[model samples]
Target chain A: MTDTEKVIEIQVLRYRPEQETEPVLQSFKVPFTDDMSVLQGLQYIKDYLDGTVSFRWSCRMAICGSCGMMIDGKPKLSCKTFLREYYPAGLRIEALAHMPIERDLIVDAGDFITKLESIKPYIIPKEPRTLEQGEYLQTPQQRDMYEQFSSCINCMLCYAACPQYGLDKTFTGPGVLALMHRYNADSRDGASAERMDLGYAHEGFWGCTAVGYCSVVCPKGVDPANAINQNKMNSAINYFTRFVTPKGGTK
Target chain B: MSKRRPYVRSMDGWWKRDAYFVKYMAREVTAVFVAAYAVVLLVGLVRLAQGQAAYEGWLAALKSPLSLVFHLVLLATFVYHTWSWFNIMPKTMPIMFVGGKRVQPGMITGAGLAAAVVACLAVLLIVRGVAS
Candidate 1:
């Protein structure tokens, strides 16, 4: 590397069970061009100074649903975040906030994945049919209702930003709730009755205190807060209507 | 048992270290404070319903050291509840637009707090007028 190339200082949070009780900042001077990302700098360190430094990444292009970390206290995809943005002072990288740290720059995301499954993440039609029938038709407006939520790559920056999720582990959180909203809004899905039962509980929509950090940190503009809050209205209506409406009233 | 295993653990105390988890804990803790203030108001109402002599006795009790300590704690909780309520209010309600531009969250919270202060002052004035 030439002297003309800018040298950026990267400070990463490190934790090892045998050596450290909690994460600590370890800084490294990395030589970089304008095109280098924070992920590349960490890779450089791992390849050179410390082979044991741990993190997660797969699709360097941001599609593989990995390489999420807290860059300067904000949850972001490390592969997409460039060092040029924090030019002079370098960068500080850590694992996603509000999740258990398994090791250096990696958090255990089992809770989020479980909540996703609880909502029956797959489509369940009202009646069984074969492929011989035509595909379930949906209008453009119906597609528009859920188009924004469909963009979620499950990077989980929203989970890190959510204080409510951090406080109540059982609370079905922002990302998972957005996914639920996606399926619920689908015209082909016939599981609203079954899904509403899970979404209406205290541990579901009602648990959200609406800190709104989830919406702010969402990389895909999923707006999971909107999904959770809008569903709260649905849940409340469903609760009140249970007494008035008979079972299987409308198709 | 089936071969399928749930990917996430279903257990307690999982959220202790998460930052978002800590935020939710703070919100729940503030809720206790809100409930405590409600009880204080309910006690006052009961005293008033018992007539002048009973209300005067309740007022005297409120001036005692233990009662004063309780009031201090209540005051702290009420402040927390008020701040948290205002912070989350914008999320629940529809956005307020003026001249085709939306009002800022901080502005909305400030206006709400000002209205609360005015309402409290109006209640004090009415109470003093009725007593005299």
Candidate 2:
């Protein structure tokens, strides 16, 4: 429409379960500004060209973590990836890697939801207190122990980036492990023993071969690699000391 | 009974697909060389325990051109293994709280590498002093 405005071709991987057995790429030329994100480009295609092109997004600022997809074969938040950076290149967009495509750019996240729930992401208090009793207090040091891991927004980007999770869905993945560490590291939480089966299992920390790409692709800096590897030490210790220590003494 | 059929994509040649995965594969492969060198050293120790003739025979075998090239490749992979091992040392250990602050990861890796270098040098110096 304009002489100076720039447009780039975005090849989206389309899948409709009822219509297509396999996913195929559909290209759309989108007019873009330098500041436009990949998510914005998909929005343009959905709004102008194809209303049936489905994807997920909420907060455009990368906080809601619903807009992750495979941008040029890497798991990334479409809201954070700028289209200008990949301009003039053959930009391929697909549903997140290692996930089943529901339709278009949306992938089924039920497995991830199940894994997240199994980790028990909330803090189980060390002791019970009466209603009239004062709230549990924490020092800055206590909060610092698990503060970085608490930043995960359940984006599932790390799971897409994890090769172990791709190869075997049974392995409890980086996001869940990081949240497990988050609660375990909390000074007031005492449920680590309950979660030890997952932490020390063959499908737990040992499943990770320390590929460490999960940390690289993490949008929230949760560093699930760090979480998984740190738990390797816990698992190793538990492996040797379990014979001596009584049950419910993993801490 | 269920409508869900999750298409599981095969990840064959996944290492070849991306540079990140290629580097990861390379790092993982270093373990092979490390194990090979361990076996070589173990054989040498066994030869030494056998007798002087057996020890000299093993030394002669080690001096062959093929063995030299193999050792060179082993050295490269061992160095890579050391570098990668040191890099991930911080991740494997519990978080260090020094003076009410978390220690930086770079510091942990740097300290580990420095300690390794010092230990290697100390061993070399001791071995040379013993020979002299």
**Strongest candidate by lDDT:** 2
Instruction: Give RMSD (Å) of candidate 2 vs. truth.
Output: 1.8
lDDT of 2 by residue, B1-132 (tens): 665555556778777766888888899999888889899999999999999999999999999999999999998898888888898887787778999878988999999999989988999999999999
- Clashing pairs for predicted structure model 1, backbone only: A98-B18, A98-B19, A162-B20, A163-B20, A166-B20, A166-B21, A167-B21
True contacts kept of 2: 0.50
Error of 1 at B20 (Å): 8.1
The stretch of ten residues in a row with the least summed lDDT in candidate 2 chain A is A242-251
Point out the worst 10-residue segment of candidate 1 chain A by lDDT: A242-251
lDDT per residue (tens digit) for residues A187-229 in model 1: 7788877776778777778888777778777777777877788
Name the regions of candidate 1 deviating beyond 4 angstroms. Answer: A15-25, A33-35, A84-90, A98-103, A109-111, A126-137, A163-169, A201-203, A248-251, B1-33, B56-132
Docking band of candidate 2: medium
Predictions in order: lDDT: 0.78, 0.88
lDDT per residue for candidate 2 within A143-247, as digits (tens), equals 988998999988889988888998898999999898899999998898888887788887778899888889899998778999999888878878888778876
Best by DockQ: 2
The numbered model that scores best in TM-score is 2
User: iRMS of each prediction in angstroms?
Assistant: 7.2, 1.7
* Residue A238 local lDDT, model 1: 67
